[model samples]
Target: MNSGISGYVIQRLLGTIPILIGVGIVTFVLVRVLPGDPAVFYVTGPVVTQEAVQAVREALGLDQPLYLQLFHYFGQILTGDLGRSLTTGQAVTVSLMQRLPASLELSIVAMTLAIALSIPLGIIAATRLGTWSDYAIRFAATVGVSLPASVLGILLILVFYYYVGFAPDPIGRLDPFVATPQSITGFLLIDSLLAGNLEAFRSAAAQVALPALTVALVVMGPILRITRSSMVDVLTSDYIRTCRAAGFNWWTTYVRYGLRNALLPVLTTVGLIIAYLIGANVVVEKLFAWPGVGAYSIDALLASDYAPVQGYMLLMTALFVVINTMVDVLSALVDPRVRAQ
Candidate 1:
């Protein structure tokens, strides 16, 4: 078992090196290839001088040879310096640190809601099969899968803002007047709670909930469908039948034995869903004007800010890789045949 785990860990880690390099190379090329020059954007004048643009480029180290620039960027990345944003003139790392907390909080809440809603509904639907509850759940999942997040965000805003009047203003994470919690890991919700500032915590949570729900609605469908299918398959397995024949109750057999085996495939789907949710949140964030990393990345792209864009891309790629690696490890652990030589 130890050898198998060790082998899997080493192989996965080694495999990730190439994947990271490929992602980095692709991001680097794609950002540079995109239209609009950061240097040009940085200079402000009716009569833009070549010297001004050159100076801006040189200051940003854009004047350096492409390979040398990439080398320097990678060297800084190793030292945890992601460089500065051309648009904001702030450190890319600092910007990410400031904004990532909101994104993380939102993602976590959305994921929690999705998991909470998906699993039981999926199990119930699968168990009931042709019943009305099953049909209703299936219909809900279909609607969720079909709706775009932007549309959902808009609908949520309209309902909450116009009809209900319960949601906070559709603006950034919090009102500018409300001072954010001091950066302890940058997650405002957590930092505020840790500091025992109930007001800040409440404010953060209130502002984040709607956007998080929008993201959750966008993510819940796939998780529901995958879990339902897996549950059905596992419930009908020979071992499950044996357990049932041995006088085990339906819920016990389903939850204890069937669910455990069913989770392998569901885990894979969940990982992919997580990756998709993170990517899809960009649209949601923009619609809600939430000051998350996705919103920051979009602004960076619009301004041709390469460093932040690169950092954002790398961060996203790293997250997806990590999630995928975890899913693979869990799946292998669940299915012993996967670890067989």
Candidate 2:
């Protein structure tokens, strides 16, 4: 069993190498093909001289042959250098390091919120299939799926911040008056608590709640639907019927047997949800004025700064690969059939 698991994990890791290389190659080619010249965008004045634009292009290595540029980029990537941002003049890695934690924190919180609410509701709806409870849950799930994150975010701000006056200002990560905690971890919520700054923690949590909720609402529908369908299938399986006939109680029969069997599909949905959350963050982050990589990438994209956009795409691709590997391993552990395969 141990050897099989090891083989599976090793195989997954090895397979990801080519994927990363492919993503890097595609990102390099696609960014170069985008309209507008980076040098022209970077150099701006009332009357910009051709010499200035040419100099900027050379400095950024944009004047190099495409093949040479690709080789240089791959070399830099191998050396753990993501290159400098043409707009900000900071290392792309540095910016990612600073901003990724924010995006991750938001994603984590939203996923937690979604899973916490979705699974139980799904179970209830499954157990009560054909009843009013199931219909209500299904209706709500449909609405959640249909609602756009941007619209939901604006409505949340209006209802909670403007009308209700419960939510904090829909601004950055924390209130202006709150002193940011010392950065032990880049996550504000964790770093605040680590530094024993409850005030900052509360402020950060409040600021994150609305946008996180917005993201959760957008993702919750798919998770709930998957869980409900999986559970319904498991509960109706022959083994479950056997358990029901063998005098096994409801808890042991459903909670233990049904939920365990239902988990694999739900787990897969969760992995896909993480990717969706990353895309949703691009909109939610901008709406909330959150300083995360999604917002950072948007700024770079508007300026046609190729390095940062490439860095963002490569970073996100690598992240998805890691998530997929973990999901595969977890599915294997959950079901012996997957491990045997």
Q: Provide the TM-score for each candidate, comma-separated.
A: 0.90, 0.95
In candidate 2, where is summed lDDT lowest over 10 consecutive residues?
A: 272-281
**Per-residue alpha-carbon lDDT of candidate 1 for residues 1-341, written as tens digits (9 for 90 to 100):** 57877777778778877777778778888998898778999888888999999998998888888889888878888898888887888999889877877777788889999889998899999889999999999999999879988888889999987799998888877766677777786777888888887888878888888888888887889889999999998878899889989999977888888788888778888888776666558898888787788989999999888999889988888778777877788788787766564
- Best of the candidates, TM-score: 2
True lDDT of residue 150, candidate 1? 83
For every candidate structure, what is the RMSD over all alpha carbons to the true structure, in angstroms?
A: 2.4, 1.7
Which pairs of residues collide in model 2? none
Candidate 1: pairs in clash: none
For residues 119-233, what per-residue lDDT tens digits would candidate 2 score against the true structure? 9889999999999999999999999889888999999999999999999998889999999999988999999999999999999999999999999888889999999999999
- Which residue ranges in model 1 land beyond 4 Å of their true spot? 1-3, 63-65, 175-179, 243-247, 333-341
Residue runs of model 2 more than 4 Å from their true location after superposition:
242-250
